[model samples]
Target: MQETPFTLRAGHLLPYCMSDSNKTDFTNPSTFILLGIPGLEAAHIWISIPFCTMYAIAVLGNIAILFIVRREPSLHVPMYYFLCMLAVTDLVLCMSILPKMLSIFWFNSREIDFNACLTQMYFVHCVSVIESGIFLAMALDRYVAICDPLRHSIILTNPMVAKVILAVVLRGSMIVLPYPFLARQWPYCRTNIIPQSYCAHIAVVKLACADTRVNSYYGLFVLFGVLGLDAIFIAMTYIQILRVIFSLPTKDARLKTFGTCGSHLFVILAFYIPGLFFSLMYRFAQNVPLHFQVLFPNMYLFIPPMLNPIIYGMRTKQIRDRLLRLFTHKGP
Candidate 1:
C-alpha cells in the first residue's frame, strides 16, 4: 500500500514519500532528500542565478563592512561595534543556507546527511534569532544617540556593547539550542524528502510519526521571545527617537537628525516586514500559492544580508567617506 507523496499539514507543503516497507515504528534514515523547490523544479537553474548573485553580494559586502570598520580607528564606537556584530550575524545567517541551497540547484546535490540537515536547521533559526537581536541593538544605539546625545557615549560604552552582544548571543543560543536535540528525538518513517530547498525545523520535523506539537510550540515561543519582543522594543525606541528629532529647533536640524536614523529604519523594515509576512503565511495561510511560498522565504533570507552593508555604506556619512577613501586610496 502507498500514501500520498505530499500533503498540506497546518500550512506546510511537505511531501512525505513513504517507503515500500512502510514500517509502523520510528526509523532514522541516514540522509534526507532535499528537493530544491518542489513545484518549481524546472526553474531551479534560473532561480539559482539570482540566489547566487545575492549570496556573492552578501559575502563581499559584509566582509568589506567588517574590514573598513576595523581598519579605521575613527569608526570605532558603539554604533560601529554593533554594526560589526550585525555584519558577523548576517554573514553566518546567509552562509548557513545559501551554500547548500546552491549545491542543490547547481550540482543536483540533494542528499544531505540527517545530522547535517539538523545542524543546518539549527543554525538557520539560531542566526536568525541573533539577527533580530542585532537589529534591536542597532535600534538601541540610534535611540541613545538621538534622544540622549550628551550621555550617549557614556551610556553605550564599548564594554556595555560587549555585554549586550554577549547577552544577545547567549539568549539566542539558549533559546534555539533545544531545536536540534528535540528534532533528533522524533521518530521518522513518513518520508525523508523535504519539499523546501533547505532544512528548516518545520520542514524536517513534520516527517516524524511521533507527535511534533512540542517542537511547533517551542518554535512559536522562540519567535515571540526573540523576534517578537525584540521588534516591540525596537519600535518603542524608534518612537522615542522620532519625538526627540521633531523637537529639534530648525528644519535642517530636524532633517539632519532624522537622517541619522533613516537608514536604520529602512534596514529594520527591510529585515522585519518580509520575515513577519513569511512567518505568518506559513502559520496561518494554508492555501497560499505554492510558488509564492517557495519564493518568498528565499527572498526573505537572501535580501537582507546583501542590502545591510550597501545601506550603511551609502547612508552613513562616516562609513561612506571611509569607503570612498578606502576605494580611492586617499589618505585622510
Candidate 2:
C-alpha cells in the first residue's frame, strides 16, 4: 500500500514527505476558520455584552419553564407538554451556537475541527426544523382546542402527543442528516473561513471546492418543504381559528378564544419572521453588508430562545401566576 503523506500531530493534520503525485490529491481540510461579524471586529466586545446577556436570559428562562412544567401537575396535559418540548429544543439550539459565538467574539478562537463543524451544523439545522414542526403541532392543538373543544382531549391524548413528538424528531433528523454527509463528501481546497459566528449550512457549503449546486438545491428543498409547509399549515389553522372566534355568540367568548392563541401567535411570528428574512438575505442579498449578515443570522438563533419564555410568562395567565408566586414565596 502506498503510504499517505499526511500525519496527525496533536490532533492537527501536518504534511509529511509530500511527493509530486500526492500534491494534487485534494486532501480534505482538517479545520475551518469561523469569521464572526466580519466588519465589526472592534465592536465585538460591545456586541458580546448583549449576546452574553441574551444567552443568560435564554438559559435561565428555558430552565425556569422546564422546572415549572415538570413540577406543576396541572401542566401535565398535551399543550404544556408540547411547550416543554419547545423549551428543550430552544435550550439545545441556543447552547449549540452561543458558546462558539461568544468564544469568537471574546477570545477570537475561531478555528473549528472539520468534523466538529459538521456536527454543529447538523444539530443547528435539525433542531431548528424540529422547532418549526413543533409550532405546527401547537397550531393544530390550538385548532382542535378552539374549533372542536369537545373532542380536543380525545384527539390529543397522551399516546397521540407522544407519537407526534416522535414523528417530529424523526422527520427533522431525516431531513437534516443528509446535509453534513453532502458537505463531508466535498473537498475544501478553497479557503476554510466560514463567514458567520457559527457553522451555518450555506456558509459552510459555499466553502467546498466541489460543485455545491446539489447541496444548495437540497437545502432549499428542505427549507421550503419542511419550514414552508409548516408555515402554511400554521396559517391555515389560525385562519380556521379566527373563523371560529368571530362566530362566537358572545364577545367574552371571542376574546377568550383569541387570548388562548395570543402567545403561540407571538412565538410563531418571532421565530419565522427573522428566519424567513435571514433565509432570503442569505440566498439573494449577497451584496448586503457582512455585519448585517452575521448580526441577523445570530439574531435569528438567539432572539427566539430568549423571548419564548418571556412571551409565555407574560401572555399565559397560569404561567405568569406561577412565576409570580414562585418569586414571591418565602421559605420558612
Candidate 3:
C-alpha cells in the first residue's frame, strides 16, 4: 500500500520525492523561484538592450545635472539645492534596478536570491519616498518665495536649507522603511513570480503565502501615506501661491512669479498624476497586458528625470541662453 503525502495549504507540497518511509515534513525543502518574463529566450534578446540603454541614460543624465548644479555657483539657492537632491534620488533609483534588471534581461538566470530581491524592494520604496519628499520641499520653497518675498532670504538661509534637505531625506526613509520589512516577513513558495521589469511593491506583495489582507492594509497606508500626503501638501502650497499671484497689482510681477514656478508645477504634475492613474488602473483593471505594467513604471520613474533638465531648459531663459551660447557662440 502507498502512503499519502501531506500538503501545505499554501499550494505547497511536502517532500514527495523522498522514500515514503523516510519522508518527513520537518526536513522538507522550501525554496523560492522567480517566474521571470514569459517566453524566456525571445524576451531576453528583444527586451534587454533597450532597457540597458535607458538605465545608462538615466544614470548619466542625472549625474550631469548634479555636476552642472555643483559647478555653477549662480545656481546655488534653495530651489536648485532641492533640485540636486532630486537628481540624487533619480540616480540612486536607476542604480537600484538597472544592474540586476539588465542581468535578468540578458541572462537566462531569473533567480534572484531572497535577500537581493528584498534589497531591491527596499531601494524602490526608499527612493520613491525621497522623491515625494523632495517634491514637497520644492513646493514649500515656492510657497515661501511667493507668499513672503521679504522673508524668503531669512527663511531659507544656507544652513537652514541644508538642515531641511537632510530632514526631508531622513523623514522619507523612515516612512518607507516599514513596507519592505513587512513584505519580507511573508514566506514565499517556490513559484514566486514577479511580472514587471523591476521589483515593484504590489508585484512582491502578490506573492505572499499567507493571506495578504494585512499587506493590503499596509500597501494602502503606503499609497496614501507617501503619495496622498505629499499631493495634498503640494496642492495647498500651490493654492496659496495662486492667491498670492492674484493679489499682485502689476501684470509683470505676476508673470514673473508664474514664470518662476511654472516649470516646477508642470514637472510635479507630470511626475505624480500619471503615476497615480497608472496605480489605479493596475489595481482595478483586470487582464491588464503585462506591457502596460512594464511601460508605466518606466514612464514615471525614467521620464521625470529626463524631463527635468529639458523642462527647466526650455522654460528658464537662463538655461536656454546658456545652451545657445555654448552651441552657437551667440549672445542671448
Candidate 4:
C-alpha cells in the first residue's frame, strides 16, 4: 500500500511516509494523534489558561443553572425547564472534549483511541444539535408567554415539555449518528493524525482515504437541516412576538414584554451567529492560516457555553436575585 498522504504539521503542509512495517497505521490505526493547534506550540501553554478558565466557568455556571432550576420550586415551569435542558446540553458539549483537550495542550498527551475519537465526534455534534433545538423550544416558550398568556401553561404543560425535550434529543442523535459510522467505513491510509485538539467531524472525515463527496453532502444536509429549519421557525416566532409586543397599549407594558425576551434574543444570536460564521469560514476560507483554522473551531465550541449561563444570570432578575441570595446568605 502507498504511504500516508500529505499532512499538516506545525503550519507546514508536508508529505509523510509510513513504510510497510507500520502499514497497519494505514486503513484504521489503533490511535489518532491530536496536534493541538499546529504552529502555535509555544502558545499552547498561554492558550490553555483562558481555555481552561472558560471550561471551568462553563461547567460551574451550567451546573449552577441546573442546581437553581431544580431547587427553586418557582422555577418548575416550562422556561426554566428548558433552561435546565440547555444547561445540561452545554455542560455535556463542553465536557466532551475539554479535559482531553487540556491534556493535549499541557502534557502533550495527544493520542486518542480510534473508537474513542469517533465517540467524541458523535457527542460534540449530537449535543450541539440538541442545543439548537433547546433554543427553538425557548423561543416557543417566549412566544406562548407573550402572545397567548392565558393558554401559555395549557400549551406547554409538563408532559408537553418532556416530549419536546425527547424530540430534541432523538432528532439531534439521528442527525448526527451517521457521522462516526461514515468516518469508520472509509479506509484510512497512513494518516491517523488530526490537526485539531478534538474530533471535529469534517476533520475526521477528510482524514479517510476514500471518496468524500457523500460525507460532505451528508454534512451539508445536517447543517442546512439544523440551521435552515431552525432559523425559519425562530424567525417566524419572533416576528409574531414582535407584532404582539408592539400592539401593547402602554410604553411601559411594551418595554416590560420585550425586556423579558432580551436575554433570550442575545443568547440566540450568541449561539447561532458564531456557529454559522465559523462553519462557513471552515468550509470556504481555505487560504486562512492554520492557527486560525485551529483557533476558531475551539472558540466556536466553548464560547457560547461559557457565555450562556452568564448572559442568563446577569439578565434574568430572578436568577440574579437568587444568585445574590446564595452568596449573601439571605432568605428566599
Q: Indicate which candidate wins on lDDT.
A: 4
By TM-score, highest first, what's the ranking? 4, 1, 2, 3
TM-score of 2: 0.91
Q: Write the per-residue lDDT of candidate 2 for residues 1-332, one digit (tens) a residue.
A: 00000000011122233334333435456777776777787899899998899999999999999988887788888889899999999899888888988998899897898899889888888888889889999999999999999999999999999999999999988988998898889876646666677787777767666788998788777767778888889999999999999999999989988999999999998887667766766676646666776675676577888999999888888787788779989421
Against the correct fold, how does model 4 do in TM-score? Answer: 0.93
User: Residue 147 CA error for candidate 4 (Å)?
Assistant: 1.0
CA error at residue 54 for candidate 4, angstroms: 0.4
Return the clash pairs for model 3, or none: none
Off by over 4 Å in 3: 1-50, 320-332
- Model 2 spans with C-alpha error above 4 angstroms: 1-26, 330-332
Score candidate 1 by TM-score against the native. Answer: 0.92
Candidate 1 residue 61 Cα shift, in angstroms, is 0.4
Give the per-residue lDDT of model 4 (tens digit) for 1-332.
Answer: 00000011123332334335334537777788788887787789899998999999999999999988877888899999999999998888788989998998899898899999989888888887888888899999999999999999999999999999999999988888898899899888746767788887787778776897787787777677775678679989999999999999999999999998988998888777767666666666768887887786686678888988999999888888889999998986
Candidate 3 residue-wise lDDT, 47-159, digit = tens? 66666666677676667567666756777888988988988888887787767666766664555766676677777777777787788999999999989988998999989
Q: What is the lDDT of candidate 2?
A: 0.79
Which candidate's TM-score is highest? 4
The predicted structure with the larger lDDT, 2 or 4, is 4
- Clash totals for all candidate models: 0, 0, 0, 2
lDDT of each: 0.79, 0.79, 0.67, 0.80
Runs in model 4 with CA error above 4 Å?
1-25
lDDT of 1 by residue, 79-121 (tens): 8888899899889978888889998888888889989988887
Q: Whole-model lDDT, candidate 3? A: 0.67
